[model samples]
Target: MLTTIVVIFLIVYLGMILGGLPFLQLDRTGVALLGAIALIGVGALSLEEAVAAVHLPTVILLFSFMVVSAQMRLGGFYDWVTHKLAALALGPAGLLGVLIVVVAALSAVFSNDIVCLAVAPVLIDACQKRRLAPTPYLLALACSANIGSAATLIGNPQNMLIGQTLGLSFDGYFLDAILPVSVGLLACWGLIAWQTRGRWTDGAALVPPAALHEARTEAIAFDAWQTTKGLAVAGALLVAFLVAPWPREHMALIGAGLLLMSRKLHSRKMLGLVDWELLILFMSLFVVNHALQRTGVTAHAIALLAAAGVHLDQLGSLFGVTFVLSNIVSNVPAVMLLLPLAHHPMAGTLLALVSTLAGNLLIVGSIANIIVVDAAARRHIDIDWRGYARVGVPVTVVTLAIAGIYLALRLHLATG
Candidate 1:
């Protein structure tokens, strides 16, 4: 049984790392679901036990936030922001700085993937209008969103899972993350600004505005009344999560219910955008990781690491391991694997921050990068790997440095 569980775990994770198994017709979500089913079939976990292994609070949190984001998406909020950013009549370098700061700030508040998806097409159009290269802005969109999402619990799915599972204080985690995120944004702007300095001086031939404008078929069909109502519910629920002393899951469910009370936007459509695959991914990983835990493999490995004086509690070691593993398997699974150790001193903050920031390391490192790249490709704006790495590599270095320094200083201050 133990061997079967371990083998399934390995295969599922391998699928995650490889972006789905070769010719297997299964993506990460399908791979994870199969792993969970395998565990139940082999009796490593009972059906009841598998259900129990899945964390409902994390799922609820993820679900509710997706609704909130969907509301904004439907309202054309992201599209509006990107257009505004593009319309700013700044030089190339100046526009690069503006784009970096704006993308980072929005991403800090919303899911990174959604932020990238919403912004990419408009940004591409905007760059074309300004007679500048869209590649730099698109890359900035991907990298900054990944970095900025590290700032808050709601910013990334992994952070949401970490925050809910560990019961980390929302305010406390934000306090820990804000400095690094702020500095990281500045660093992101600097790197992008330096790279685009010369290109802005000699503007590329402009693409027609009509061509870009025609791409937006889905207009912002916002009911101001409904949008305001959803925002109010979301804000109240956020406060409830932080301070009202209600269970986080219950508050989020209330918020979701309130959002569902709409006259125009059907709940069916809202629910469709919820990325059930991602929720399933989380559910499946929970079972897989829990099944692995039953084999005493996790505990044995931790004990060995502890005996060797390599505690995950240490800031340096924690950051190093998280950066490597997150880049390998993506941030969500990496968070699930390491979250068992989140009870260690300052571990929740470390886990959330490291898992998120590590996403900036490569093209496949974060879903946000993938979303932006894919969106651009759909519009015939090819942002290939080489184009991405121009911004990705430098952005990763600067942001991680800022995060590492901030974590080290906090640890020092806390210990002192």
Candidate 2:
């Protein structure tokens, strides 16, 4: 049983690293789900035990926020904002700065992936219309979204997992992360602006007329009432998470329910936007990891590493490992793997910041990056890995360094 569980764990994680098993037509979520089923079949864990392994608070919170973001998307709030921003009378660099700031701010509050998904196509069309090159702005959108989402615990899935698992304070995490995230956003803007210097216009727009027409058709008309309702719920939930003595998950779930009971938007539309695959990925990883923990393998591995002077509990060690693993298996699964060792005072904050910032390392590093790239591709714009790396690599290195220094300073001051 132990051996079976171990093999399943290894295979599932490998799938995570590669985005799927070779020639299997299975994605990370499918691999994880299958691993959990295998564990149950082999009696490594009972059905009840597998079910108990999933953290309901984290799942509920993630689901609730997905609904909220969907409401805003269906209301066309993101598209509306992009058009308004693009209509400004700013030069290329100034517009890039504004794009980074706005995307980061919106991502800090909403799901970064959703923000990118809704904004990228519209942004591309907007840029083409202005006779400005869309590539730099697109890269800025992806990098800034990753950095900005690091600002708050609710900004990304991994952060939500760490916060719920560690019982972290929403406001406290925000206070700890704001500086690094701000600096990282600025770094993204600088790197993108520098790379595309004086080259803001492509000779001819790459986007086809048909693609532009399709984008317009798919865009939702901005509905004031729906957008306002979503904003109200999000704001109230923020206040509740900070001040009220309530479970953050419960508060967010309540907010989602309120959004569902709307007359203008159908509940089906909002719920349809929820990434059920991601939720399943979380649940499946919980079971597989819990089974591995029961075998004492994780404990033994940690002990072995500690003996070799590779202690994960130390801030420096944790920061390095988080950065590496986040790029390898993507942030959410990487956070799940290392979360058990997060016992240090600043471990949660470090994990949240590094895991997220590291996603900017490559195109395959984060879902937001992939979403932006895909959106661009549909409009005949190609942001290949090399193109993305030209911006992604530097933004990642600089942002991670800044976060490391900030956290180290915070730790020093606390100890001093």
Candidate 3:
């Protein structure tokens, strides 16, 4: 039974690393869900035990924010932001910088994958209309979104799980992440801009003004009142979550409730946009990881590491292992696997930063990357692995180094 569980778990997670089973229609979410069912069918995890494995707080928190982000999307908030950026009239370099900052800020507050989903197509069209090469801005959008999502406890699913499990304060975690995130955003801008420097002018000829004007004509129709209301509630909820003593999940739930009260936007439409598959993925991983723990493999591995004097609290090994594991299984699952042994003084900060930054290493390293890539592909704009690696490699290196140095400084100051 243990071996059956182990084999199924490995197959499922390996599918995750490859983004799907070989030549199979299943995606990461589907693979994980199937793995959970197999464990149940094999009697490795009883129904009650499976239920116990799921961390409801994390799920609730994630669902609530999805509602918030969906409200913003239905309100045309993301479209409005994209249109405003298109109208900036900046040159190639300046526009790249603007794209980096705007995408990063939005992703930090919202789901990076959703942000890319909503913004990438519009961004590509905008750049193509302006005769600006869309590749650089597209890369910037993908990479910066990943980097910025590392900045806050709720920025991404993994961070949400880490925060809840570790009881890390929202504001405290934000403070620790702010410097690394800011520097990482800046580094992303510089790296992408440098990579695309002269290519901007060498691309297609100027897009006629008429074409540019026509492209902006379909800029998503916005309901001004709805947009304002969503932004206000989201803002207030954010402040309350940071400042008030209430648990963040409860606070976000309240905020989501307020959004649903609107008469202008149908509650059903907003609710439908939530990524239920991702929530399922988290729940499934929880069960699988719990089963693995039951098999005593994790305990044995920990004992081996401990005997070799390897602990997550140590700066170099922690960062190194985090980088490798995150890119290996992707960040959320990797964080879940490592969270049990993350007992270092700054483990919370380290796990959040390292796992998040590690996503920038490969096209498959993060969902945000896949979101942007797939979105672009749908538009017939191909952003291949090599093209992404051009920016991802440097961005990962520089930003990770900054994160490590910043965490070490924090540890030094706290210890001193």
Candidate 4:
């Protein structure tokens, strides 16, 4: 039984790294779900035990935030903000700075992927109107979103997972991450601006008319009331998470329910916008990981590693492993795999920070990166791996270094 569990865990994680099973139609989510089902079918876990293994609080919190993001999208808040930012009379560098800051700030509060999806096309159009190049700005958007999302527990999926799983304080995590995330955002802006020095204009023709028209189809006109309501709910949730003793998931669910009761945006539309596949991925991985843990293999392996002087509970080892696994299997899955080892004092903060910032290493490393790239592609602006890496590589290296230094300082303060 232990061997079977180990085999299933290995295969599922391999699929995560490869993005799917070889020649199979299954994605990471599907692979994880199948692995969980296999364990149940083979009696490694009873149906009841599998269900119990899944963390409902984390799932609820994730779902509620998705609805909040969907509400903002349907209300055209994202589009309105992008347009406003474009209308500023700043120079190329100044505008790039503002874009990075705003994108990062919004992503810290909302879904980073949705922020890119809603803003990218309109941003492309805005750049064309200004005769400025969109590539640098688009890259800034992706990088800032990934970095900024590290600022808060709810900033991205992985942070949310770490926070909920470890029961970290929302305010504590925010305070610990603010410095690294802010420095990372500034570094991202500087690198992109320097790369595009004196070449803000591509002098290229506007995107194909058909592509522009298709992109515009997803835009929602700004609805002030809906936007205001969404903001109110988000603000209230943050306050609750920080101050109130209520369960975070319960409060988030109530906020989602309030948003659902909206008369203008139908609940079906909001629900449709939620990433059901991502929810499934989390649920399935929870069951699979729990079954594996029950078999004692994971604990035994960690003990062996500790004895060999490679302690994952230490900040340095955790940071290195997180950076590599995040780039390989993407941040969310990587977080799930390493979260069990997060028993050190600073482990949760380290995991949340590294897993998120690591996504800036590759275009495929994070959903936010994919969303920005795909959005650009739809507008005929190709951001191939090479083009992305030119910016992504530097941004990732600098940000990770900042995070490492910050974590090291915190560790020293704790030990000293």
Instruction: State the displacement of the C-alpha of residue 2, model 2, in Å, after optimal TM-score superposition.
Output: 1.0
Candidate 4 clashing pairs? Answer: none
- Cα lDDT tens digits, model 2, 180-263, are 899888888888888888788963365777998988887889998899998999999999888999899999999999999987
Candidate 3 local distance difference test against the native: 0.86
Question: How far out, in Å, is residue 277 in model 2?
Answer: 0.7
- Per-residue error (Å), model 4, residue 32: 1.0
How many collisions between residues are there in candidate 3? 0
- Prediction-by-prediction clash tally: 0, 0, 0, 0
TM-score for all predictions?
A: 0.94, 0.99, 0.94, 0.98
* lDDT against true structure, model 2: 0.92
Report the C-alpha lDDT of model 1 over 295-409, residue by residue, as the tens digit.
Answer: 9998999889989999875667777888889999998999888887765667888888778877877789898988888877666667778878878878887788877777788
Which stretches of candidate 1 lie above 4 Å from their native place? 201-214, 218-223, 307-309
Top candidate when judged by lDDT against the true structure:
2
Tell me the tens digit of each residue's lDDT in model 3 across 1-416.
Answer: 87898898899889788878987899999999999999998899999999999999999999999999988888788888987898997888888888888888888889998899888868877777687877788888889898889989888999999999999988888889999999989888888778787798544454455545544653557778877877887788789977898888998898889899987788889999999999999999999999999999888887789789886556677788889989888898899988987788688889999999889988999888988888666555668999888889999999999998898788889999
**Lowest lDDT block of 10, candidate 4:** 198-207
Off by over 4 Å in 4: none
> Model 3: what TM-score?
0.94
Over 4 Å off in model 2, which ranges? 203-206
* Model 1 lDDT, residue 176, Cα: 85
Instruction: List all candidate RMSDs to the true structure.
Output: 2.1, 0.9, 2.6, 1.1
Residue 340 error, candidate 2, Å = 0.6
